[model samples]
Target: MTPLFSFLVLSLKFLSADCKTEAGFCSCSCQKKELIMKAVSILTVLSAAVFGFFVGISFPVQITPQLQCGILPCSSGDAANYSFSGTSMIGILWSAFRNTNIQSNGTSENHAVTKPKGAEKLPPGLVVTESDLHMRRLWGSPKEDVATGKYLLALAVGYSEKANVNATVHKFSDEFDVVLFHYDGRTTEWDDLEWSKQAVHVSARKQTKWWFAKRFLHPSIVAPYEYIFLWDEDLGVDNFTAEEYVKVAMKHGLEISQPGLDSTRGKKTYEVTVRRNDAGEMHKTNEGGRCPDVHQRPCSGFVEVMAPVFSREAWTCVWHMIQNDLVHGWGLDFNFWRCVDNPEEQIGIVDAQYVSHHGVPTLISQGNGEQEGSSEKVRARQWAEMHTFRERISNAEKERGNSAAALEEYHP
Candidate 1:
């Protein structure tokens, strides 16, 4: 019995003796003593039940140290061997309590218990596990397992433009890894060129450059290259050399740039992209009445999508901005400023090394016999895509505004 129960029993015995001490009513006194003893017995039983309930509830707390001993290594010889089975109720309760305490304390041990092993070591977002385009020999140990080029040159080409493509490839030295995107599905025909064996080729019939880039040039796949040159196949690279262009871009810190279009040689669209004879290496054009602001596009902070060169960091942002279905890349050049901090300074036209835009009609001629009607249809689709992109941007901005307002109201 507990100490309280023993004390109560002794008091009941003393009360019974006092009741018997009363003379002239021994019978009544004995009855009263029996009644008092019965009351004491009931009280003792209730007290024991209450004590047992408390002990049962506190069982998990009492075993917490033991549970810790099982989870973590203990210096004590006895505790080191202590085993805890989670199958029992007490063990489950202890585990829950331990986890709660650890989370409240904000300890790294909580992360260790919840996250998978080696999860913290991985980079954010999806990781690419497949090998790159770098070729390997089958016979012997190679000096290097990957491509040594620091830059990447990707072109969307057709067999009709083979002569122009060959000239463009020669402009870039061994420091670049060449990748050809064949829209005509005619890769074997280009084998006549000696460099075609070394270049990587991807073929699909009647697809635009944007479509090829979106599906193939994921940021992770091209992470090793410092700069990526995505160009059209019809450009004349007579005045352009890959090495000199890179040096000029690096000197001026151009993150998103393109070669200036020769005014006298080929078809030109934007006045800003026209090469300035007076500029040294790079120049940002100014349109007096066209652009409302000096920092806006079509004047400054812009590069055409035809022959754009993107730094690795800039391309990571641009890759996400490319809409999957909008393969024509309409209105993409206008929004390129969003990827860079100061587009006016980082985005420019390389004047010293410039190209002639041949304005080739490769994709327009692929449709059914009516070339003029097909060209009109292409223009109509480009217009529709531009409007759709603008609408999406507007909707996103409104949603962001609403969310911010709601958050502020909740906090305030």
Candidate 2:
């Protein structure tokens, strides 16, 4: 107690004297204490921040569907639907396939398509083949692709794209297996597509408003397609598939199936050339039955090449009829259908499955309609020839059921 108590008393006295002296200098001792405390607290916060740099605190990030396609949350690799922001991908791929198919990307499957590789170049049982078309377009190293039984129901335009043909093909893609064979000269490079891998090199059937429906059959190479679907390219197709076409034909036992067609200027399918009676007066019903008779269901005039689906049997029946008597490159479809007689010979018309005709000439406009500016007079002459052929076909059908009568005459 003597030494310890003596030291403790001295330390307490020293602290008390020091505090009294400090308090004399600053009368607000408690306030000073708070200021010092706040400064120390700030310093402590700063030290904690510095330490946190070395040892970080983790937090979660919000993952969202903001980075997706078509308003759908899709994974990495699945092929999903997308809106196209650029030019036609289908035309580009088709052109690329035709160009490169024989050089670097010659498809082996296409080569082996013909049953006897030595006998023919393509598969058997083709109804219409325009294999000669490869020569029409200045293709030196043109490649022939045997279709995987996929047919393109096309309808080309005349004078211009008055039938909305391009738009029809674009929308038809969602349902039907179609190939829009356009004649615009802007050849595209299909750099992004993988055509050599999966897509079959389709040398499919092509029909056009001007070519098949309006014009006569041109000398074609791919014309041997088992069932050439000669129709209007501008025809609309609502919720229809390739299989549905086959199903309708097979189910109905139809050799020829003519779907409903729309006139660009009107609401329902309009009648252009009508039938006349013995008095030469145009009748609601023509002798050849241009528009369907009242007893018959209201129907389209001619085959509506805009949406005509021909079966193999029908093809065999009507092909020879048009092939022998093709006046020009127009009026072949109607003339061919005129030959289809057996009321049993069916041409299925699915009005529900529709497509719009008279497309805006986007492709043609983009290409500036420059076909080497060949010969204006020559072009005019050719157009006149085409329309003349169309008139001849309409008149012929009025007199005789084109294909039906032709077949009977030919066979009998």
Top candidate, metric lDDT = 1
User: What is the lDDT for 340 in model 2?
Assistant: 59
lDDT tens per residue, model 1, 1-412 = 5876676666667565543345736865766677677777878889898787556545543221343444575522234234222123443545465453423322342333344345645542433342344445677557655555789999999999999999999999888888899998999999989888888999998889999999999987788788999999889889999999999999999999999999799988878888888777889766563655655567788898899999999999999999999988877888887889988889999998999999998876655554558777877888898778776666766876643321100010
Worst 10 residues of 1 by lDDT: 403-412
lDDT by residue for model 2 (266-385), tens: 234333221112312111222344544422323322444445566545655554545233323334444544445643235334433333444442322322235654345334544565
Q: Which ten residues in a row have the lowest lDDT in candidate 2?
A: 274-283
Per-candidate Cα RMSD to the true structure, in Å, reads 11.6, 26.1
The TM-score values for the models, in the order shown, are 0.67, 0.38
